[model samples]
Structures are given as structure tokens and as C-alpha cells.
Target: MEETINLKELFQILRKRLLMILAVTFTAVLASAIVSFYFITPIYQSSTQILVNQKKADNSIVQYNEVQTNVQLVNTYSIIIKSPAILDQVKKQLNLDMSVQELTNKINVASEKDSQVFSVTVQDAKPELAKDIANTTAAVFKEEVAKIMSVDNVSILSIAEVAKEQSPIKPQPMLNIAIAFVVGLMVSVGLAFLLEYLDNTIKREQDIEKILELPVLGVVTKMEEKKAAAAAVTKVREQTIGS
Candidate 1:
């Protein structure tokens, strides 16, 4: 015979194991909070924007063709900013101990769509270091691009500044705890169902009837030891008083 469960049984199962579920959920949330706050390193980001426009002669108005050319060159400049040529110079200028690859990993360059403006962002453990790296990278790239491509078009629009109050971009404690809470609830519920399924002990007459395909003829009532002893003493007292 096949067995089926209903909503009532599901609720009963959860009710029976509610304490275990809550314990697991609380444990997961606590572990996530601890790890997020203590173990992970915090990263700080600083960014500077640079404009790629052609250097025209004295008081010359910008032309549409020149704007289009600068827009197209933004992509090339973005890639060049992370290259060894620019990164090596940035490392030397900053007196950084990291290699070209390590420095490249810390820097990112991006441009606005269909625009000649691009930004260089740097991330480091120190907020001041991040600001310095961003500004220095833009300066070094601007100076080197002119020599490398023979185009004096790169200009710094803004330099990154150290923030008075900064926050890390990674290891969000609340988000991590929320995710762990969800995972813990799922695992705990799954384990509850698995334990219920594995338990084969008959708990009621209905269970016995279902398993054996037989009707229950009778059921023996259970009696507590104290109640049975009291009843026996009363019967003996009544017999002695009648005799």
C-alpha cells in the first residue's frame, strides 16, 4: 500500500522538531555574523575620472568629428590603463611593493557609454592608499598615453580624495546572516522529514491496522502502578468489613 501525507501531518512534524530547527537557524546566523565581522578583510575603494578629448589649437571650438574620435578611443584607453606599461609606471610612481599583476588586480577602469569620460577605481585595505592609487594611476596613464600613442588628448577631470568616513565594500554581515538563516531553515526541515520517514515504530492502532491489513479487535488499557495499588487496598478493606 502507498502512504500519503497531508498539511496537518506536515504541521505536526514541524511542531515536534521546532526546537531543533530554531537551534540550527540561530547557530547558522551566529556563525555568519562572527565570520563576517572578524575573519574577512575589509576593502576600501576610491575613484577618479579622466576625460579623453583632443588638444586643439588656441581657442579652437571642439568639432563633432573630434568628439566621435575621442568616444571611440575610450575603449582602447580603458584597456591600456590596466596594461603593464601603465601599471608598471604607476607602481614605480607610488613606490608600491606589489607586482604589475597584483597592482592590476587592485585597479579597474571603465567608461560611460557613448561618452569620452572614463573613471579609474582602486581598492585597497587602506582608504588613503586607495585614493592615492586612483589619482596616481590617472596621472601616470595621462602622461604615458601621450608618449605611447603620440596623442596629447588625455586630461584629468577630477582626482580622488580620501573620505573622512569610509566603509568596506565586502563581507556584508546582515546579508550573510540572512542567507545562512534561509539555508539553515531548509536543512533543518529536510532533516525533520527524513527522520520522520525513517521511524518505523507503530504509535497507534491505526498504524498497526494499516501495516497488517487487519482490523483491530480490541485494545488493552494501560493502568498506572499507584492507581492499581490504591484500588487493591480498597477492595481488601471492603471484603474484611463485610466478613
Candidate 2:
């Protein structure tokens, strides 16, 4: 019974503040949509893939050990691809205005473990620039790795290309609004309970009972002036009869 009553009270509190919660949630979603669509800058992404393979020393077919070695080198190659030697050349070839560190920050290299193929992804404000950066970085890395590693095993599998209709990869307004909706609902519900907890003024019979730990005896109703005069006379008459 106590658990049911507590649940009822909680439901009542939430119901009383439902409008406030909805309003807050709506406001939060609207703000997120506006920021996502207008305030945040869109970023476009492009990627190029490169393959690593060792050349056969003789006419005989390549061994599995050599293939494994090439796969292991992918980790080192991923690092070297982001190094200054590769990025500096990439910057020079592209005539980019950014520094090597800035260019490095924009590039991402990823490959599955034991995979001979790796990818270089680039993000920029412009789709063309992203495509150019991805392609140029791969070309420079392929050329420099041969000299640095003393081998010609790196080969370009694919180059980044701009599509006829390109789209940005970031600043998704729908996703932002969805996140805001959940966050706003949680915050608003918590705020409602907090406000309810802090309110101490007694406004109901149950509040009085809970505070006093006693039952209410009776309620004295207020009357108009004419009704008060009539009641006073009736009280006197009843007292006279009792006497």
C-alpha cells in the first residue's frame, strides 16, 4: 500500500510538470536544429586506398612469409604516411596554404589487422580540397616510402575522386536534434523532481496529515455576512434550549 501511494505521488508530480517538460524538450530540440543547420560548419570527407606487396626476387612465386612481412609493415607505413616527409611533399605538390601539422590533423589512416591494403581519409571544408588532399597524400607517401624503406612495394589501389553530387560528412541536424531531445527530457524531469522536493509550503490535507501525523477532525466553512448573522442567532437559540 505504501509503495503504491508513493508511486501515485510520483506520477502526480510528473503529471503536474508535464507541460514544463514538453516545453523544455521542444526548446532544446529547436536550439540543436538551429545550431546544427546554421552555426556548425560542414566537413567533407574523401579517401584513397593503397596496397602493399613485395616483388619476387626470382621468377619463382612469392612466399607466404614475405606476404606476412608486408602486412606487418602496414603499421609502420601508417605512421610514416602521416610523417613530415610525406606530408611536406604532399603540401608542396598541392600548393596548400596549411602547415604540415595542420595537414596531418586532417588526415586519417586506417587498415584492418593483417590486411595488405590501407586507406587514407581526409576531411576538409570543401569536397574538392578533401579529395585532392587524400589523393596527394597517398601519392607522396607511396613515393617517399620506397626511398625511406628502400623498397618499391607500395602501390596505389584507388584515388579519391569527387562525385557529381557530393555531400558533407558532418553537422547532421537530425542526429543533433535526437540527442538534444533525450538530454532535454532527462534534465527537465530531474529539475521537476528537484523543484518538488524543495517546495515546503503545505497546501493540502495530506500535507497536513504527513506533517502533523494526525487525522483532520472537521472543516470550518466560511459564510457571508447575512449567513453569519443567521447562524449566530441560531446558535444563541440552541444554547437557550439546552439551558
lDDT tens per residue, model 1, 161-206 = 9767788888788899999999999999998999999999998898
Cα lDDT of model 2 overall?
Answer: 0.92
Candidate 2 deviant stretches above 4 angstroms: 57-59, 220-243
- The predictions' CA RMSDs to the true structure, in order, are 3.6, 4.2
lDDT against the true structure, each candidate: 0.91, 0.92
TM-score of each: 0.84, 0.89
- What is the per-residue lDDT of model 2 for residues 1-243, given as tens digits with 9 covering 90 to 100? 999999999999999999999999999999999999999999999999999997666788888899999999999999999999889888888899999999999999999988999999999999999999998888888888888999999999999999988888898888889999999999999999999999999878878899999998886776899999999999999999999
| Total clashes for model 1 | 0
TM-score of 1: 0.84
Instruction: Show the lowest summed lDDT stretch of 10 residues, model 1.
Output: 1-10
User: Number of the top candidate by lDDT?
Assistant: 2
